[model samples]
Target: MILTRRAMLIGATTTLAGCDRIGSNARFREALFSAENFHKWAQRSLMTRDAMAREFRPDQISPIFRANGTANPNTPEYKALWRGDFADWRLRVDGLVTRPLSLSLAQLHSLPHREQITRHDCVEGWSAIGQWRGVPLKTILDGAGLRSQARYIVFHCADRMGTGRPYYESIDLTDAFHPQTLLAFALNDRPLSVANGAPLRLRVERQLGYKQAKYLMRIEAVQHLSGIGAGKGGYWEDHANYDWYAGI
Candidate 1:
């Protein structure tokens, strides 16, 4: 049944993969230009979020859950901190803010925390229910003081994609404060595995897997995405056709 559902989702995504060529129909391009229209169309054709994605009962937990992304960053800077158990790994919260913060792992955990058993829905069609513990991003943002012009929050990571200098991602303020959003440090009641973004990672629950960026090193509030690395929202969004608005 899972495989059948998976096939259907792929078939649907393929159907929407329209092309843009010289002399492309003006009407077709116009319709897609309004991203809001594309968003509605995509949601209609893809798998909607299932209730299984909610906080799961302990009995429903999965053992041997798969981890995603770089298990450990290869940078000597990261390795040296790992040897020290990340006591000095500070998360720089800068960009358009009144008072930027330099947060340590211990300082992050000192803030108010929330725990939720959310389902991780990968664009590849796998799903897992796991509990995550972290501080609300709003509390962190408010404490840092956002400028009125700051429209989005970008997460700079310590990992790289392909030959790219480093991997980075961002989201607008609305999604940043969504009740399900968190800067998670623990997964399934234990310190998160390095593969799953040890120390800290983002859990923006309403989006797809890749949007849940890992290896968080800095947080920057910005007005527009135009100046950030190729002016694209993320690596997958830039290289692959992963939609920027990946709301489920």
Candidate 2:
């Protein structure tokens, strides 16, 4: 039988709650992440891969869209961008494309854009509604003439967790081109704040908040993920054994 969204999320939470135990045992760690992969595979098998997550009316916008992960990217480069109001910031998109792009915030804003009011669901068990405005990720990918061989899109972010490793995330092309996937620069009708991933952030609407990587610095389309950090496709996946395909 197909599981409800709540049921799926609850199961994920239960799995996450036991991560420490899994981490302590090498065999168990493998088993746990293996199960996470199966969870992702099962969800894809049972549900439409491109189904949109629930969107909400503007009235439902949360008064406080609590920031998840890296409120402020303390790196010198990020600090400089924040001080200059991101006037010099550019998002680099390269790899496995006929054309590469280095786009500034203004350039991104000039492109055809989309606005959506969507719910942000965190793995830590909180949800918030917010209006996000940005260009669809596919718009950028298409503009770059994404190569047919490209299988995954990786995000390199500026934020570093306490462990001092930089944040990173990846998604398969299926999610990369999803209608609701955005490279959002604005939230709630205003410029995004430092506490909320200023400059740019990802919005993979169907996934949980952690998959919505913040402080995006670069996007690379690659044929495979084996060369990326730890070959697991993301920071948390490499460090905490969080599912690489965090489909919500």
Candidate 3:
């Protein structure tokens, strides 16, 4: 039987609840991590490296794309940028790159862009199809000139979680260079609203919604995930035990 994305997410959620009840069980945690690794391996092995995520026609786009996670970061720094219409905001690209970059919003807009109407499957079991327009992430990576040691792309965002941790996420180079992966600045033919990650957000189409880090302030290339927040890759992955490889 084929399991839909929603079904898979629901099953994962149920399993996570069970794991929470057994939180102190080291063996159980190890088993869960092993299972997640296996799932990622199976998906990658079964599909071509550049396999494209399903995209929809413009008419199929959702009438209302509900914003996930924080609507607005509301930090003084973010608010200052918002007030200036993000003209002063810059996306820093460094860490394991031959040449670091500090790209302004206008500079990003000047780059070649791609637009796709794709479905966003959220772990919370809600999905929305929206048209996203932005520079392909590969374009940015190529410009930055990755050092040979770089294996992952880390997104640093402006939003702070309830625990006062900055929101962040990572993806392997495979996803980073995927044709559909983008540093999206516009959604549905308009500049992204603050609630929808204005100025910049990531569109790793093949992954779950949480992997699409929003309010992006920097992109860092790293050799290992160990030095990141709590060493689990992302805020949710570290604090809430969400699987790091949340591939759909």
TM-scores of the models, in the order given: 0.81, 0.88, 0.91
Worst 10 residues of 3 by lDDT: 24-33
What tens-digit string does per-residue lDDT give for candidate 1 at 200-235? 899888778888888889999999988887677777
Write one digit per residue (lDDT tens) for candidate 3, span 217-248. 99999999999999889989999988889885
Whose lDDT is higher: candidate 1's or candidate 3's? 3
Off by over 4 Å in 1: 1-37, 40-53
Clashing pairs in 1: none
- After superposition, the stretches of candidate 3 with alpha carbons farther than 4 Å from their true spots are 1-23
Order the numbered candidates by TM-score, best leading. Answer: 3, 2, 1
Per-residue alpha-carbon lDDT of candidate 2 for residues 76-188, written as tens digits (9 for 90 to 100):
98889889999999999999999999999999999999999999988888989999999999999999998889999999998898889899999998899999999999999
Best by lDDT: 3
What's the number of clashes in each of the models?
0, 0, 0
Question: Which residue ranges in model 2 land beyond 4 Å of their true spot?
Answer: 1-25
Q: List the residue pairs that clash in candidate 2.
A: none
Question: Which candidate number would show the highest TM-score if scored against the true structure?
Answer: 3
